[model samples]
Structures are given as structure tokens and as C-alpha cells.
Target: MSDVHGRSSGTGRLVTVLAWALLLIGLWLWGRGVTGVPENPARPGTGDVAGLGTATVPLPPAAEPLGAAPPQRIDIPELGVQAPVMARGLDSRGAVDPPPFNRPDVVGWYGYGTAPGAAGAALMVGHVDTESRPAVFYKLSTLKPGETVRVVRADGRVAHFTIDDIRVLARDDFDAQQAYGPREPGRAELRLITCGGSFDRASRSYTANVVVSAYLTGTGP
Candidate 1:
């Protein structure tokens, strides 16, 4: 698969193809390239975690209070994503990190700014390519608008979101105000990000980013 997971978040040039694509997609995919992908070397709850609205610029407004999202699976059939809910937070770059694939028994979170299901645009990102093999989110860029995305909570409650749109962008095009900025008090939005565009070997990064936006539907059985 492709190893182009996670963007540079303005690191230093996006490893040629790394930062290139996700800037617009909000730190799109990540790396490594292998099957049975290495069980996240990251111990659960080990990363210097930041609860929603912690370190992000200006700090987004508080998230809608949740009754503790029960542990469960978040699945987006269209993209073939099915991972246990764990906390995903910002990678070294301040951009949100997605849960690693293939281990959704618990819940892996990308714990950075906003909670995954909170108000505004809560995001969950993942990988699409690796130098060796394709990752869970490899095809995440291909999801069509209106496709159904599902997140099952520990309480057996499932929240369904229907995609509103999918677009590609450049790193410079990334704007937190629009991306992470809050929406109406009760408004809920979801975004899934990944790498895309042509790979520029000289730069070692992709030319653009792939983004998916969705709106909450409701929890179901």
C-alpha cells in the first residue's frame, strides 16, 4: 500500500509528497507500508493527549457535552473503514491523528482539539497508502457525497452521517476557521481526511489533499 499517511502540518515541506496533499484535507493520510499493519506502537492513552479545545489556536468553543460516548465501532462502509473507538489526538504537528486500522475492539481516538462527535466539525482521519501496502483509508478519497458513514457508540447507539461533499485542496488552502471552526450550537459536522493528488518524488509529497464532509443523521440499532 501507500505509506503517505498524515500530512506535515507545516513541518518543513511535507516530505516531498507528505505535506503536499493533506494541507487542504486537514493533514490527510500516513505511512510504513505493510499488511496486518503494526499494532499501533502507541500505547493507548500514551500520546501527550489534549482534550477538545485544548491547544488549538484561539481554542474552539467547548464541545457539546456527551454522556461519555460508549466504546464501540466507527464504520464508514463506503470507505471500508471499521475501527474500534479509541481516542485520536493531534500528531506531533497539531493536526488531528486518526485511529490506526484493524483494531476497533476498543476505541482509538485522534484526541486533539474537538471530540469526534462534538459540535462543529469533528474529524477522524486515517491512512490511504503506504510504501508497501494500502491502508484502511486508502480509498477514503473515493467516497461520494451522500454516502452513509456510521459510528457505533459503546452504548450500542449508532450515529449515522451522510456525506455532504468531498473535495481536494492544497496545504495552503487549509483554513482552521473553516475546517475546525465551530458551527451552530447544535450543529454537527464530520470530516474525514487523507492524502491525494500526484506524488512529487522530488518533493516527496502529494500535490493535494482529499477531504470528506458529512452531517449527523442519528444513532441507530
Candidate 2:
């Protein structure tokens, strides 16, 4: 009986792994479209400064990328956001698993991707709202360029970023690479993502995603 139980448990784990693999493949296909090319341009629609090549205000120059270090906390002074950061992996649905509804004040960093201060676009996601009220990123879309976003790192240094772009990308033609990709090569960039547009009752999801792009401008102790 013990052997049989062990075999059953092993089979269950295997099935779970297979299911995740299938779901990831499906998500990749859906995002890449049938022809393996993105269905829309890198920036589509008029979601707030889509046609504008740069921020409306003058911004500081990009700082050199820092070495890899896990992030501990994030602060957006303009939005009055000072939240703890937790590393998160992909969920069963093959997407970044955001903080649980109960912990709506937390931010989830993509653990499998670039570190917050590394030379790549680090991805951070949070819930815009729970069933009852607003979440951590509820005011994310309201952030304008030139605002400051500071990330406290585990290495005892704070990475300061300057907001450069904001886009409300439609869900129908969402391009992961474009939304999360580094705007400039060798710069340590960050993308803060949350749900935007209007919530749809039929689909039970937001019609678009709010993507706020920023790059490292300086560091602090």
C-alpha cells in the first residue's frame, strides 16, 4: 500500500508539471499569434503619449546599470506608494503570479527575470484592485514622466529610477516583448504593470494593461 501511495503521488506531480508546460506553450502561441509574429505594432493605440517620442518634461540621464541584487522594497513618492517587494514566479496560468488579494499592498517582482538594478528590464506586477477595494498599483497609471521610483535592494543600496513612459496597452493585441523590453540597450530599466482600461464583467478582466517604464537614474545608500 505504501508503494502504491508513493506511485500515485509521483504520478500526480508529473501530471501537474505536464499541465504547466502545456499552459505555457499555449500562452506563448497566443501572444506570438499564428504566424509567429506580433499582431500589432510595438506601441499601438492612443493610450497616453503613444505618439510622443519622449516624456513631456526634461528627465535625468540614465545611470550605469548596477550588479545583480534582489529587491526588498519599492517606493513611488508621487503616488505615496511604499510597499514591500516579494519575488514571484509564474502561476498555473503561465503568467506572473501577483500578490494575493489578501496582500493587496504588496508588489511582486518576476523572480525568474532580470534583477531590479541589473542591465535589463525588470518586471514588477501588482493588483490594481481586489474585489472590495483598490490595491497597491491602483494609482500606477496616474504616474507621469520624471517622477521618481526607488527600489531598495538587498545589497544595501537603493536604485533610483525616473519614469519615462506610460502606456495602456490593450489586452487583445498585447505584446509582451514590447511592453517589457528594455527601451535602450545596456540600461537598467524597470516596468511596473497593472490592469487598466475598464473592467469588463463578461470577461471578468480589465480591457487593457497599464505599463509604466522607467530607467535607473541614480543610486542611494
Give the winner by lDDT: 2
Where model 2 places Cα greater than 4 Å from the true spot, the runs are: 1-54
The C-alpha TM-scores of every prediction are 0.61, 0.77
Q: Model 1, 12-96: lDDT tens per residue?
A: 3334334323332434223201011232222221111121111223322222333335335678885456766666644554355
Q: List the candidate 1 regions with Cα displacement exceeding 4 Å.
A: 1-71, 98-108, 182-185
Best-performing candidate as measured by TM-score: 2
Model 2's alpha-carbon lDDT is 0.72
TM-score of 2: 0.77
Looking at model 1, report the run of 10 residues with the lowest lDDT sum. Answer: 45-54
Evaluate candidate 2 by giving its C-alpha RMSD to the native, one decimal.
10.4
